[model samples]
Target: MTDEAFKREVKTLYVAEAEDGIRLDRWFRRRWPHLSNIQVQKMARSGQIRVDGARIKPEGRLTAGAAVRVPPIPDAVVRAPGEHQALSPADVAFAKSLVIYEDDLVIALNKPWGLAVQGGTKTTRHVDRLLSAWGEGMERPRLVHRLDRDTSGVLLLGKGPEAAKRLAGAFARRQAKKTYWALVIGLPKPTAGQIDLPLKKTGINDFEIMRPADAKEHGAEPAETAYALISHAGQRASWLALRPFTGRTHQLRAHMKAIGHPILGDTKYGDAVSAELSGPLKLQLHARRIELDHPSGGKLIVEAPLSPEMRAGFQHFGFEEAEADADPFAGVRRMR
Candidate 1:
């Protein structure tokens, strides 16, 4: 575009609390996806993109309340509130098939194992795309958070932008509580204890993994998980309940590995710990339950049934789901 056009079309936006800490390029892609990565990088390099009135890199992390100057882009297609993509009837039906719970403001899915929450490189079918089929004239479905592709259960979505913003804020503020269930190779030493460890990312993109790190290490982020032993199969395997205080990339998986009790079927972090186990192995981590204040009113609590693989594993280990406590983290104190 010409400089005059760029000058006329340029805009400034403030980062919301829910958008805090995301990469600057990600913020642009979320809002103006037609602005390609190449375009964004060039714009940033040329000082056409600035944060708080100063030039910033595309990969720079954004802070809450920071103002960003966005340059006009060719072929930019920004959607206004209530606008959404159209989906086929088959997609709509597929989206409805996963619904475990929903209300006027929220929709919760019992996301199956191996299904991705968002689309990525070569990821055509995902919860985000399916959401477009969640019917029309509903102010566009929005995901409040994410679950790993291999992880199953309790994937939450908002019916509209307002609801999404509120739900995302609750998560960012640590007000949303999530409980996970995992079948591990062996029992935790104390039976129940907190996995207090700092973590940092290693590798990149699809190959990325989290690793325990010193608190003083650069790029290290605090990660804590309060775990409780629910059931055990002697020294062979154990069913554990996990409550993560801080959400980091692969935090639960890395922490479990750091403690020498990796979740079963997690080949990436488990290091073939389940190699000797009989029968087929699948990632044994499940987001069993979640609790948070509803966008409308009152508390919103939902629980997902165990996945098919988890059921089979439970049967194999003779672990009954009912044996788990009503509130698995009831005795675990909340981290300040």
Candidate 2:
């Protein structure tokens, strides 16, 4: 059947034992990543999506053995299944080298800096394209989350649709805890605190950047970040561990800048002080660690070590990598 025809073909599903207690909206996201929240709500309101033959609210809960009526969803609202892509042996090997953890359901990679997770204008090489190497006769793995093109660290990929849905839910529900490490130009005065700042996107296209939102900005959203100083180089720079309670694009960068200590090497938001810092000019932000619920059950915690450039910067400042192992935000009051 044509792809469009196949997508529009209605299907009924019995809620599996494993999917019990999931929210209705989350259930749909797990099954159809392409469906927008608005689309799902529209379907539910229009009686196109039903559970046990009755229309349900988006936040309605599901139980095992429940019969779900899933209408013919359009192809545009579904994540396209992976297509076969030819990959060179060297490309395949390079992709495999980034794998820090993997299982039947998921693969976690220590994504290198400067590699885009997805393609965009003027961008060609990315983790998504390279994922073709992992196809191995199945659908290409799906991205469960994203890391910025200049940020390096633990990036997760779901092996299939089911796995992708589960992992994505973990992220959306704030069940995932992520730790980032960065080198900032100056130490935050309090040493450990939270930056509760709302942010909104500014500019457009290639020039786009995130800025602290004004009180009256139309689409500004709340953003919060918790940070603790791991070590400092005598006020010149500080090594910090950041935990973002709410994920926002460039939240850490913008929050740090708001506090007058923008992360070193972040050209978009860093200040003149950061620009004056000598040494490698690459962004110093790293996705150091992540903890989340695994699709197959139980908790998964993974860590990615510092890249060579970041390690070199750490060494130059006499900061110990072992210091990062300690909970930087421990005992600090959350600023909210």
Candidate 3:
């Protein structure tokens, strides 16, 4: 609740009827319940706020009544010494681009949602802190996989450190091939299915990872699958594509909020009940796509596109609006 009174607690909501696009940092931790959309996105990039006048991303969107501003929450730095210099200048003016695709092992970036490839409980600048401030004097970007702090898309850094331990051991055996594009809220009455269940970790920041309707914790033993591939309805919810094979911990957002099809503006499991997301919102999830196997054998893919508030709610539900101009990097670049 610091960051200068959380950007003077911005204002200008409307998107009623269960808060439209939602996601302005979980709508400013649900209109400021002691602030936390990661502290209103580290106070909207340390320049206070302004959505619509720019200085955006706290996953901005809150439609239905648009106008969100919320500016006034700066002053909060600490780490010094040229602030870990690399591509400094406040790390590309609070990271808006780092889209790499390097070689000689691996490197890929396109991520850009309140940024945090690792570090929680009130993050402290991540993506290994601007890739260790662009790895002063070279090679330091680790983390060969991780996305959540309001998931964005396609991140995989590793320029040394044994190619980040063989790309985090190929995402620990799952052979890395994620893929997501949520907009969920309802539908699964067979709208293309698969949920194999068997998850665990109830809570602790444990950051939710359910799937135990009590049948003795449903024989938990690592059983996830996510392979939907269809769901586009709207005006009420539906826009999946998921593809996880197993990578637990909020595995596709607690299995799409335990089959209730949450995901859309998911505030600790979507069901916020709007009123302007009360203040900041836009959950429609999106880590869109990812593929791997680049230890020199070739074939690696990355993707991330579909965030114009989930393409303006699929052009406000008017007959698919041509799937948003077909492949404007469709789900963020990944194909033969």
Q: Who wins the lDDT comparison?
A: 1
Candidates ranked, most accurate by lDDT first: 1, 2, 3
State the lDDT of candidate 1 residue by residue for 1-336, as single tens digits.
333443366655455443557798887786555668998899999999998789888899986546577776565365433223356687778788888998889989999998887655445577876875664334457777778889998988877656876776677777788999999988789998898899988886578888989999987888888999999999999999998887777888899989999888887887655656634868889999999999988999999999997887798899998898878787567665
- Among these predicted structures, which one has the highest TM-score? 1
TM-score versus the correct structure, for each prediction: 0.82, 0.74, 0.30
List model 3 lDDT by residue over 1-336, tens digit each: 442343454433222212334467765664344454667877777746655455777776644333355554333354333322345576755543666477776767767666666544355566656764444323455555566767766677666655665666666555676767776655566765567765655654444445544435633535464545354554355666776666655678777777776776667766654212313435556666677777667767766665565565555443253353222223432221
Compute the lDDT of residue 323 as modeled in candidate 3: 51
Model 3 Cα displacement at 229 (Å)?
A: 13
Q: What is the C-alpha lDDT of each candidate?
A: 0.79, 0.76, 0.57
Number of colliding residue pairs in each model = 0, 0, 18
Error of 1 at 245 (Å): 0.6
**Span of ten consecutive residues with least summed lDDT in model 2:** 76-85
Candidate 2 pairs with clashing backbones: none
